[model samples]
Target: MRVNFTIEGPPVGKARPRVTRKVTYTPKKTSQYEDLVRYTAINSFDGCFDHDEPVDVRIVAYFPIPKSWSKKRRQLCLINKELPIKRPDIDNVSKIIMDGMNPKMKRNKQLHRMVEVMRGIYHDDKQVTTLVVKKRYAERPRVEVRIKRDMGD
Candidate 1:
């Protein structure tokens, strides 16, 4: 089937902005797996924004799941898995990120806030499949903190 839609723009100055048209086509009975694959490919960039920065740190948390899972399910799994890292009283989000780091390193407020924003993005349980952190090498942040869940027999 073919779908066409128009996006109307807000009025500016004395003239109305022209509307833009979008078109989409889909085949019949496509598997939900196709959506999952597309979602994974699109989101693969989430944790990779700062990868090339020499002074920046990057951490990646990978969950054991295939692309067949929906985006929401993946995010929920990440949130449920990483909930222990959340902080209650910190006004600045970066503090939470630093707090999530290894306690051995002295806490830096900036690092902590970065982690908090990253964590907050994943709180929805629909946007994340894994969480990764990248930081400067000097910080020596902990690479892995496992969250265990028991499946009852």
Candidate 2:
């Protein structure tokens, strides 16, 4: 199955450390990442997916280009070493998307190994999250193998 939709929110990462206190720390329950996941899970059609098997997830993150950047950079007219680097790396964003699908995913299965995820980013005028999920199958690459035999044999 395929799910194509956009999520509007600031992308979050899992790198943040838990609160250090004597009281209980609800690590898995509260965080910006978790909040976004909760929101997405409720809105996304991702619930329709049956996660009893492996799935391939492809998501693209589009971040708003900083207005502070020079006109040349914004227009892509200057091709220099200056990169359009942004917070929350592609991998982190992908993780957030997977976590958002946690409710639909079976916990008994090793989610990481079973999931084939792909991610990308683009600096644009809008902040958007595009997600796509589909079934994964074995499509082994074709390789030609040949054996040599003696003519006299």
- Model 1 agreement with the true structure over 34-90: per-residue lDDT tens digits: 232223323332332222222222232222433576777656655554222222222
lDDT of 2 by residue, 60-83 (tens): 454444557677665562332344
Tell me the TM-score of each prediction against the true structure.
0.15, 0.50
Best by lDDT: 2
In model 2, the number of clashes is 0
Clashes of 1: 23
Which stretches of candidate 2 lie above 4 Å from their native place? 19-32, 77-83, 104-153
On TM-score, the candidate that comes out on top is 2
After superposition, the stretches of candidate 1 with alpha carbons farther than 4 Å from their true spots are 1-55, 66-97, 102-153
